[model samples]
Target: MHRDTGRDVVVPEGLLRIEDCLDATGGIALPPGVTLISLIERNIANVGDTVAYRYLDFSGPTGGHAVEMTWNALGVRMRAIGAHVQRHAARGDRVAVLAPQGLEYVAGFFAAVKAGMIAVPLFAPELPGHAERLDVALRDARPAAVLTTSAARQAVDDFLAAMSTADRPAVIVIDDIPDTAAHDFDPVNIDVDDVSHLQYTGGATRAPVGVEITHRAVGTNLLQMILSIDLLDRNTHGVSWLPLYHDMGLSMIGFPAVYGGHSTLMSPTAFVRRPSRWIEALSAGSRTGRVVTAAPNFAYEWTAARGVPADGSGIDLRNVVMIIGSEPVSIDAIRSFNAAFAPFNLPRTAFKPSYGLAEATLFVSTIAPDAEAGVVHLDRQGLTDGRATPVPADHPQAVAHVSCGHVARSQWCVIVDENGDELQDGGVGEIWLQGDNIGRGYWGRPEETETTFHGRLGRTSTSGSHAAGAEADRTWLRTGDLGFYLDGELYVTGRIADQVCVDGRCHYPQDIEATVADASPIVRRGYVAAFTVDGDARVVVVAERAAGTARVDRAAAIEAIKAAVMRHHTIAVADVRVVPAGAIPRTTSGKLARRACRADYLRGTFG
Candidate 1:
């Protein structure tokens, strides 16, 4: 039975089942009034000699060797880094970490947290002008110090040399620091409410914002994840290739592994260039225990097409729980992956589609372990007609997307219209969430913080008194996502901001792009993009044809796409610009960054 508690759907029976699991497992109860750093410190005391991190130092592009760091060794390294920072930087200072993924990055992060400093992590220099971008972030954040590796030292030095002396943070090389510095200082007491990190949101200056997440908020979110997903069992180990800078990568995988005393394998670029390595790691790691890892929706499609072998020998996917998130959840991607990996004994139920954001400290809802990955097909016309009508799989123009599942224990989610009124089931609306896991607010910008974090819906309190005004007492986060709840599960449609309105009708760009993708051989499925141009919407497609392929004969491809889109949505495409393969902009986690692409298009760089 489901009970609507205004903010979330309560499953009382599911809560009982989780409690039973917790009782049987005898898991660590999170002691009150403790910081995230304390959890790591306590785990080190108990699991001193156990392996905490496994790293591969790729000397060159050809070959590399592996190294392991025990819990004791990692703790010692963290303390040393922390001590160095404490001596050089002030408490509550922000420290920027710019380096490739490795053991050093992990150590630098924890050390900052231990020193009562906020760690600001950014991607390594990859794209052109990345150095300039890093410099901007460093200057804006005014970090006390910048942590980098020996290899990155020269690059960082060069970047700093270009900036004024007063604008640069103190650059510190991890390899140059002495190990003896670890014992020089005593551990300081940390408050759970202290800011742990300042996570920057993706966007240009007009929309730039950073969410200030506190230790208590992160810890509470992790606890909710543990309770909701049964992650406290010793048999479950965490593995991730998601970049540590992102909130999902940090809080969901990194913090959980550290605090839960479970071993984790982290590599930033490993899964992106070669997804098979992730599966290989998962299979090999699962011999000791079950492996839990996560990636965005595209990774599943990419890996399914290239990673798994046909015969399925030497691959065991049965014990792997692949949590897919960080972007729009595609039912096609999930089903395709399941079918592709089924020969390797991959369980259909192992694909977990979840919903979350940085404001919630990462996870807000997750699919139940026993439940099959959820998918719902809606009638396209009805969806555009201001209502959601579930259609059969065989129906024409049926749009299928995966559900993000039930809400987290410490959080509540709701679907509300633009007026902040609750929408009935199957009505697409903005996703609003409120709970302890909600982050403190965006850092530095009070106006943006108030607008983003403190908005409301008028509702009678449990005490039976009506609260008037938008900011009465309850606060709900405006997720800016369009989705609906079906049978108690939340299925995200697309971003509300991404929707293009024309002639009194709302058109989802993703849907138009998907239709275009189906009609053209050159256009890769899920590679077509649709965005607004001036006042009208335009379609930009990136096809997978050979680099030197002739474009003169592709008129039919364009015509087919135009016809399909017009037939489906009655919206004429303003223009169709087809570029070479790999032209689409994607996030580090493999999510298609449509906004980034639009920015690139405006700059005339997307060809």
Candidate 2:
């Protein structure tokens, strides 16, 4: 952020620092009864002129263009868009934002929520290969208005035309809304509990569902995320290429807003086209302060393998804290990424592995940025038998799982059995979360929403650090993720819903999939899916071959994968299928859609 932001409300030097806003306890505190919009207003009052956001436009005459928006401008534009949205939709109506990732999208997202309407943050119609997700979310949300930019207007219109929705939403070109419209903007008295946005789940499974997030959920979780990562240790700037529609990507907006600092962003497409741009953005944004960025495990691997320059040249990651989350954390990927950048002063502790889901409003726990991410090798049999027994890192059956971190203050997590009875540390079970950050529930599926959002603590829950904090019979958000705690830190294993059983012993497909991935170089990493095949009763492993590999013995590859799995897991594969590259299914966020693959196989779609 610039020292002077170009003012709407200039604040004194005393209020300039976030550290100065600490409460009597000498700890950070969010003001009582404040909404995300009001918090932005507070920051505007404090540092309205400071640059709040900067977008790196990759499509330009010069190959790149930088666009900056100050707090004052951001505030004015959000209000302007809000006013225009209010004219088309009633308060509390759903307004879908399908704008491209940039200042326009951010402003419109904030505006819809500020207008007291539920904002549905989604992507433009043309992002390749996610049409099903777009269709599902649009039909489910049934938005009263579609917020988009002139660049995406025709595409958005065409997308809507194909949908069999009850009504065609009024489409507004958000960038076309002028700042002067703020003069007539009605400031909505938004309650903290109001459903601010419908955050759609990253479809690791079929049938996408929307999680209802509130202003309070967003605000408090940002605090949790920032505090966990020690973001405000210095004047901080956030840099990200994660799509803003995703929960983790929202931090690009929240972190800077919370700290009254600057955030540099680029479209996910920009980062994908050239991952080196990520490092470049990090280096450039260092001018503002320490840079905090987040991404899934694969990104780190991809960037390390395909993005880094051979020369140490110009890149410095010493001031960067990269939060890795939203999926299973790969210890090997993290270590390799760190080692690849060691020549450039990248800190060993730069990659912080965190665990979160949309149901918990996206942040649950994370290894502190100052510490090396925790890794424990658990005995494979012990883990599958419901014990998180630590084993030597070199043990053949040792499963290396990264610890997400300790339970943060004011948040509670209790491992529970299928019956909801609490389990002790080292006992693998469903992760139950209880915190202000937990979202209310799913958008319209009442039955699923109730089961997912409202879970009670078992009678015998009183031993660990999480016990006292988690009251008896208190409700928890069942994470549906299988994990166990060891030495106070949480280690997530896999998703309960994705687990497959063989001979009454439950097995996490990730283990089998990992074994199969290493069977041969022919297998594409992260593209293997393990599941049951009894229309479905027997175990099946389906993996995609590496792209561009022309001549190969398909039978030989399948046999190699099956032998590797049996050697490692002692489970004979009922069937092994080696399909062409990109033949396997994956969620929109790029996770292997295992169940979807299983369905495709049963339907003979793979043949």
Candidate 3:
């Protein structure tokens, strides 16, 4: 029988079969007292020459080559960087890493952690126009040092040139460090309770806040992922294009290292430039062993749109398991990817949709590795009433949602109504989470921390004890998202702040945005945002036009968008603004920043 997340849960038959396989395969187990530092040390001793990281460097003199690093070699560089960092900053100090995406970035991150400092991975300010974001993070994190490569050192200098000299952090180029420095390095012992890193949340709503992840929290979440992804009893390899700065990307790199698995890393630019590389990399990895990778929903849709030939191009994907997360899991995206890649041998069971945030140290829960994603077509009206009423696939008002599986075994989640009373399965409400994976709180923001981290359930439990109150002091995280459960699997509906209420009827922005995208040809796909003003009781849509569509009639496109939303969601649109491409804001991970768009709309920034 499958184990429950926290309370008694009936094991779904599909999961039970997975458990049986686990028993047959001798399920994977997490190594005790594991930290990134410890994992590196162990791997250095046991598998020194085993490839720990393989960065696909496109700009090298050779023009696109794998920059390989073995456990031992990586260990030496990390120690040297650690020595340099410790010489300048004390333990617990924040060191901002603004390196190009390569070995230097990985080494710098580990080095900071190895020196007992809180590592902050951030994009180099010069590339991708992240100067504003970098400035904001540096100001908030107040890092004592900044790490960069020789190539990006000039950009880092330019970025620091704007800040006050007194407040500026000392910049260290990772490539300039001497190998001899490692011999002089004295390693710091890490406590499980010590803060490991400050992973800033993707700023979809406002400025990003650093989430304080502890060593204990990181180890716990890594185990949660290893168990959830079925990494044990299998030779797991990874291919990832996620940015190293984000938690998801770091998880892909970090989790594999901790599990003694190897991953092939490519810059996010590579995947966006040619989505087929991700498919090809997965195919290459699968030739030797089972391959695991993760990406946001958009990447799947983008890859499917590439129309890779059914001739396969020597791509065999039967042994690949793609873990989709970092945004709301889209049933449409998963289905499209499956259908597009099926002719090339992609198994229907390959897509595993999961849910998580930075506050939880990365993963929360995911579908069982071997099973195909479970989808339920629910009536939109049922969603409004906070009940997930499943309808036929062909139902007129049906909206399909993919299951994010049960909560991580190490974690517990409770859905609570507006008043904070716990809601049973099928009852839609805010998702509150409790677990060891939960972070300490938002760094340097105690008020926001208390409000976000310390949520409590209202009313008494079935046993007549207060679920949470004075004795507990908001023990659960107030995840600002809305979702419900069916058959013990969680279905995230939408973000609470982005929910659109027009004419007393509630609508999810994603549904409306998807509707608008499909309604018009000129309006670009994946660049739409839908939201309502505070006092306005109507829907407003802002969509970016497809490139080379400057000649297209904006007024007609707006009309089409409004008509589409009215026909599909049956809601009248207050206004529609069609702007040029790249006008709408998106998070670093490529999720549409709806709140930011709304603010821009009010400020007439769109005009």
lDDT of each: 0.70, 0.82, 0.81
Kindly report which residue pairs in candidate 2 clash with one another.
Answer: 5-49, 5-50, 6-49, 533-536, 534-537
- Alpha-carbon runs more than 4 Å astray in model 1: 1-30, 57-64, 127-136, 204-208, 252-260, 310-313, 459-472, 537-552
Task: List residue ranges in candidate 3 displaced over 4 A.
Answer: 1-32, 60-63, 307-312, 460-474, 503-505, 547-553
Report the C-alpha lDDT of model 2 over 1-607, residue by residue, as the tens digit.
2232343322233333444434675444455545677667767777788888999999775788889998889888987898899998998999999989999989999999888899999999998767888999988998999999999999999989986556789999997888889876776677888998999987786578999998878877887777778776638888998888888888678887677788899988788789999988887666446898988887888898888876847777778888888457998789888888888878888888999888888888898667998788889999899999989999988988998997665678888888888888899989989877889999889999889899877655567645664556667898889888888888899898788787787888988888998987778887789998664368898888887655767788788888998898888898888888778877656678886788789899878
User: How do the predictions measure up, each by TM-score?
Assistant: 0.89, 0.94, 0.91
TM-score ranking from best candidate downward: 2, 3, 1
Candidate of highest lDDT: 2
lDDT of 1 by residue, 458-552 (tens): 43323311122223466878777788778878788887777767776887777888888777676777776787767654544444453444654
Which residue runs of candidate 2 sit more than 4 Å off their true CA positions? 1-29, 164-166
- Comparing 1 and 3 by lDDT, which wins? 3
Local error of candidate 1 at residue 64 (angstroms): 4.6
User: Rank order by lDDT, top first?
Assistant: 2, 3, 1
